[model samples]
Target: MLTYTPPIAEQRFVLQNIVKVDELSGHNVFADVTSDLVDAILEGAGQFAAGEFAPLNRVGDEVGSKWSPEGVTTPPGFKEAYGAYVEGGWGTLTGPTEYGGQGLPLSLSSVVMEDLGSANMAFSLIMMLSPAAVEALKHHGTEEQRRTWMPKLVTGEWNGTMNLTEPQAGSDVGALKTRAVPQGDGTYRIKGQKIFITFGEHDLTDNIVHLVLARTPDAPEGTRGISLFLVPKFRLNDDGTPGEFNDVRCVSIEHKMGIHASPTCVMSYGDRDDCVGWLVGEEQGGMRAMFTMMNNARLNVGLQGVSIAERATQAATRYARERVQSAKAGSASRESVRIIEHADVRRMLLRMKALTQAARALAYYAAGLTDRGQLGDADAQARVDLLTPLVKAYGTDVGVEVTSLGVQVHGGMGYIEETGAAQHYRDARISPIYEGTNGIQAADLVGRKLGLEGGAVLASLLSDMRAGAAGEAPLMALIEDCEAVAGHLATSSTDDRMAAAYPFLTLLSVAVCGWLMALQLRAAEREDGDSRFLAMKKAAARFYLDQVVPETRGLRAAAMAPAESLFGLDEEAFSA
Candidate 1:
């Protein structure tokens, strides 16, 4: 069995030096968070994830979740482990202090999330979705709604689930048919079926709060008429206790390829035409409100990719070190060598490490940006917005690649169910597809992020890269190439520009990741001791720049080309 350990030191370095988390100390919201406090939190979280959560990973996968006509039940020990997690205050790490939360910066929370995902991603989804619900309430809910739900949610006494995807409507919200008819008592009667709802109806919590998207009776056709609602599985009494059943029931659970312990439910609302729900925000603004949670979910999904890749890398690296195979070429002795001694195996392992580290840096850097957007300097917030889509899209895409590589490194064992590497590969597949697919993320990168402030954010980012080079010959050459690409991308017309958007986004992500790694290398050089850390950073950065950054040349050309090439490709050519 593979034992998972988080690279906490690397995470801390990224948070402290690359993202400058210390600067957030002065902010009113972040005044309580200090470096020592954050470190302590991470230490405890790392230990718990490795010791407690990780042990259940294989067991949960083997036993899986059992679904009956009554409800879904997780594997044994999950309930206990989750209780310990909540008791430790891990669930409320990033919630607002006013609502029974620890009020820590999301950067710190994200590090903990990475560890949890590494241990067991299916288990982590429960906590992940709850905070998302809290965020939605915090942003758009009425004062009454906040007062009623925030404390329970933030305290983890009750869990939450996002109810968006239905059987008929998966990605296209416009096709949703869930109906919420207005009632006389400032509530709505909701009737619909929701599928693939994680933690949809679990016995782990006292109650489940669902942030459901449904259409009002008067709602116009399409997404414009969608409204957000707060529907609880168990109704709350006047004294804040669990009351009558709210008419929400889980009809079935999906038989998934991975993450079996986490229930993916098909829930039917208002089977009795009595499911009561409260309006979250103004009527017909559900899509806007949902974006608040969607953005967070998207970023976290990217972290899922990072977490799985890290776990897979750890497992593969350990296997390579212990598994003996054929001798090296031209060896005098016939004794077998460890697999890691083989050139091909080393190459595979190195690629795994390089890609995983690069993705980690990117994901953590994005977390820092999210924190900065909320608590950093003005210019920092701008950079965070620009990088959000790239981080979410690119990081998760890389996650699928890296985790897949992990399985490949294991050879035949990787394909077998018992080896566990296959699970990482399967779980990671959903990350790039869900929470908005990578393609949608690319579209968002070009459609919204790249065009922000008429492209000033990207321009400023390029300028910062140039400034970071500071006349160093090697760095300067890379900076000059990146600038040239940026220049070409900047001048392209809209029709021609759409053709380049995806590749441009890819280039921008690789360039930014390379820049961050380079900075890490320089900082590691100046520090005393920990030469291994610095050396690894330098090697990873070198690999990224030498191998990965060159891909930008092709991306740049594609972005700068006329639109005809993409649009002109015959549809029939894509057929077999």
Candidate 2:
């Protein structure tokens, strides 16, 4: 099993030095967010995740989530671990204070989630889904709905899920056929099936709140007609206790490649035509409400990538330090040396650490900006909008890259499941696909986010990167590349922009990450700290700038490639 040490020091450094979380305390909304509070959160979350969650990861994978006609049963110890999480108040860190929450900055919750996800990615999804639901209710749900649902979700006494995907409607939410009909009592009768609903029917909690997307009869066609609804597994009584079945049933759980304990359910709603739901937000406004939830989930999904990458880096580093192999090529001694002594292994380890740190930096930076935006910083909000797709797309891409490298570093043992390196790879494989596929993330970035403030958002980001680069030539060149590509995207046809989206996304993401790394390098060099840790930080920062940032050059060329190469290919050409 891979033992996860929560990288507490690294998180503290990023929050304090890089993201400068302490500065948030100056805002009225964050008046209570002190250094001690931040430290307490990181420490407490680390202990719970490592002690209660990590040990169950292996069993969770082996036994997986069991499916019965009644409901889905999570692997052994998961229920208890979840109870402890709720009791410890881990989930309430970012919830509204009026709703029994701690009212901390959202970034603090990101820090906690990184640790938890590192320890157990599958279990962390249960925690992750609830916050998205909370955000949706906070932004769009009625006041009564908030009073009814927010507190329980905040306290983790109840769980929540986003039911957007159906069997026929995967990425195209507009294609969903789920119907919501008014029942004349200010409620709705929801009838449809949803699939790939994570934690949709888990037994960890007695009640599950589902934020489902459905269309009311007589509504306009397409996404404009879709409405969001609050449908629960069990209806609440007058006293707000679980009373009767709400006709939400889990037809089955998917057999998956990884994160086996997280139930990806096929949910059938209103099988008996009795499923009751309350309309959330206005009818024909589901897309707007759903985006509020989705944008939140997309960022956290990116955080999942960072979390998994961190764990894989630690596992690989430990293995490289302990696994003995052939001696140095030019050494006189015949004695075997640890694999870390070998150049290739050292390269892999350094790349893993550097990329993991870059991903974490990107995620934390976005989180910090989110807090600033919440505090009424218009520019910060604009930057966050531009960075959201980058964080979601790039962070998960790094997660997949680093975990795969973790497996390679373990050599043959990594191939076997017991060593745990392979599991990291498998678990990470889903992140780029989850929330929204990385392709969609790329498309969103180029098609919409790049156009924010008429391209000023991206221009400002590039200008800041150029200034912060401090005359680093490679970064300067990459910034130029991003600028040129942004101009191209703005002028290009729809097909051209779509064709360029993926690579353009990578190009811009690496540029931003490289810029952040450069800033961290300066901070690390100035800090008077443990020589080894600071030295490692400096090395990783330098490695990323010198090695990783250059990859963007090729990406830039690919981003500007003609759309004809893609559209020119017929369907048969892709069929092998």
Q: Can you give the TM-score per candidate against the true fold?
A: 0.94, 0.99
lDDT of 2 by residue, 49-153 (tens): 999999988998899998999788999999999999998999998898888888888889999999999999999999998998999999999899999999999
The candidate that achieves the highest TM-score relative to the unseen native structure: 2
lDDT of 1 by residue, 158-201 (tens): 99889998888788888899999988889999999998899897
Specify the highest-lDDT model's number.
2
- Model 2 TM-score relative to the real fold: 0.99
Candidate 1 Cα lDDT to native: 0.82
Worst 10 residues of 2 by lDDT: 1-10
Against the true structure, what is every candidate's RMSD?
2.3, 0.9
Instruction: List per-prediction Cα lDDT, in the order shown.
Output: 0.82, 0.91
Stretches off by above 4 angstroms in model 2 are: none
